[model samples]
Target: MTEPNSKDPAPSPLGRRERLLLAAIAAALGLLLFQLRGGLQPQAPLEQMARRSLELPVALANGRPTILEFYADWCAVCRSMAPAVEAIETKHRGALDVVLLNVDNPRWAAEIERYDVNGIPQLEFFDREGQSVGRSLGGRSLAELDAIATALIAGKPLPRLAGVGSLSQLDVASTPVAGPRSHG
Candidate 1:
């Protein structure tokens, strides 16, 4: 204590072990925050199905029954139905094909028009021979979806459900109804 040596440094309040512990805690908190910020979170069901979906052309030509879902990222009904669609896809991975087309994506504009997608989440069901069998025009419960999938897989008629209808081509002349407000 003889006037402490000039070269001596002051001791840190925290010991080396304490500092290490603090650093570890800080790192853990940072990681947790990153996860909370969605950096490490699992993908949403819609995104997961989209990522795993096969192309429309490929799915159509694969000699398997196919389900085409027209959806948009911002569509709440579509998001709500994503989990059921995903489950159907997973459950019929080999026997059937599930394809997702985002309505917001310009690449699917032709399909959007082809399918007459005035509203979503529209689902078009195709048979093994790639023929359009039926279409569902709105969100459906899991049981309804599963029933549809099961019928399609078994080559049976789709279950009779609201918003569900068989698809077919018709040859007829059409004319727009003339009205004061009609643009056609």
Candidate 2:
């Protein structure tokens, strides 16, 4: 047997082939983890709708009935109702327009005020003429949304729903009746 040289450096515990194999394993694990993470947390339906929703102005002016939803990302009701909204949008595509506006975003501040959105999940229903006919506050079930969509597509009156209110014109243009003024 040959004696070890005192001045020589010790050999590496891992050979080049072993090191390469370890690197490959680590890379595979990293890739798998990344893929798993992505697969585990898919994008929510609300996010997809928000990304694909038509702009408010365009939707209202397109001559199609519009369903404008005001929501926040953190609102539980909005999240829960997103799937139904998405379904309605899909079912009424080309005949009706569905628009989603995030209330938390400052870009929609004007719309929020115009629609008197005091709560999340406020839905404003507009006719084909771009006139707002009604609004609904709070979350709605799939059946309710579908019914509303059907009415809009058929050019009929929206179904009476809980938390829903009509936007009708007042008699503001009529001449005032004679009345005694009290200045006391």
lDDT of 2 by residue, 1-184 (tens): 9998899989889999999999999999998988876656654567668779888889989999999988766677888888889889888899999999876555666676677777767889999999998888888999999999999888999999865432222222231232454111
lDDT per residue, candidate 1, 1-184, as tens digits? 5787989888899999999999999999999988876686564667668778888888889899999988866677787787888888888889999999876655666787788877778899999888999888878888888898899889999989974433222211221233556431
Candidate 2, superposed: residue stretches over 4 Å from native: 1-41, 164-184
Model 2 lDDT vs. the true structure?
0.79
**Model 1 lDDT on a 0 to 1 scale:** 0.79
Instruction: List the RMSD of every prediction in angstroms.
Output: 11.3, 14.7
| Pairs in steric clash, model 2 | none
What shift in Å separates residue 56 of candidate 1 from its native position after superposition? 0.6
